[model samples]
Target: MDQGIVKLLPAVRGIAREAGEVILRYYTDTVTAHVKADGSPVTAADNAAEAVILPALHHLTPDIPVISEEQHAAGKSPPGDHGTYWLVDPLDGTKGFIEHTGEFTVNIGLIKDGVPVLGVMYLPVDGDTYAAAGPGTAVYGARARHDVPISCRVVPADGLVVLSSRRHGDRERLDKFLEGKLVKEHRHSSSALKFCLIARGEVDIYPRFGPTCEWDTAAGHAILLAAGGSIETPDGQSLAYGKPRYLNGEFIAYGRK
Candidate 1:
């Protein structure tokens, strides 16, 4: 990444935090959820969060076009013709948020030359923010916690700590994938936050067989990479971004360095 682009990450993280606050604002109330054309849920939180993220992102990097969920819900298209852009999931885990699980998050990712180079994931309920850009990664926990640099730990000799999607895990596929692995523990989770967990080495791996959009994983993907971890296919290829329609296929996240 360019030094200038790396410098923009702090501002981007701040914007994601602001958008997370918007989510919290709606989270505290009885917000309604609506179904989009694809049968996915959307809520006031998603829109409000995007309203905060989109403009601030463009302000931070005027040349980058932002591709966000709500914007596409409004019929906007991705400017794939551009060499660099942003992928924003103003509110990730809408179902979790709607169910009041406190698992929802705000995701902001910067894509340069078709790869995610910067990412920020903010959890609103507790105001925890995890960010990664150029050469390193960091986390800002809530309650006056000092921002701390973070990295993925090498897998311990004991066993693997596996994380599965709380909302969309394919149990059979996962079982088959882990058939011969020494699994010490497993957790069910929702959203890109799982990627953050792997980034910080709290979890060792995450496998997703379900469908997901680019924005859904881009931010956390960047963070995981910066933490010296990786998100890749079962066959071990790094997930590439800016594909047609911004869709993503099955992939696995690994915490090992």
Candidate 2:
């Protein structure tokens, strides 16, 4: 890990947690949901959380620019520079959050040269924090006494367990894929949490054919990769960051090393 990034972990974690706290404040209290032009829900929590997170990221790494979900929805995009930058989904799983499922997450990732090198994903409901700075090592939560080391499974066998979205399940395709194979399914509301489950060796795979943006997966991708898992295109190509359109194609996260 770079010394700078190592030094930055606390700041990033603090920002994520604080933003999560802010989001939780307005989660269920606000009745009406704000929708974007595309008809996706955008609550006060999303904008409020981003307001807290983006400034903190800028203060932590003044030179690196931030690309956030709220900003992107507002018609902003990352620069064409090939240097490092921050990717943030200040309130992931907005629908879940709005529904008061308590499965939303605050994500922050450091991407360099088209790949993530450091990332943090924080779940406010449980106060769980997952972080990784590089390959082969991931530390979750605070470092003093509660932090736990996490890694992915090395070899997945038959009866493999997979995590699927609770709100976005596609029964037809999932049933077709699981047929003739021993499989167990676990459902979760947040994308980042699903990735954390795979990173901690609790799930074998997560496949998504639905639409998602770069910010939605960047943090989890970094943590999963650091824990020896991989996020790749359906055809097995590695997932790349900083695309012009910001929309991600179909991808699968494999648990095996």
| TM-scores for all predictions | 0.95, 0.92
Model 2 CA lDDT for position 218: 87
lDDT of 2 by residue, 102-204 (tens): 8889999988888888889998788889988888767677434488899988545556787778767777877776678667555555657888888988888
Give the lDDT of residue 209 in candidate 2.
71
Candidate 2 lowest-lDDT run of ten:
182-191
Candidate 1 Cα misplacement greater than 4 A, ranges: none
Q: What C-alpha lDDT, on a 0 to 100 scale, does residue 114 get in candidate 1?
A: 68
Q: In terms of lDDT, which candidate is strongest?
A: 1
Q: Count clashing residue pairs per candidate.
A: 0, 0
Q: How far off is model 2, as Cα RMSD?
A: 2.1
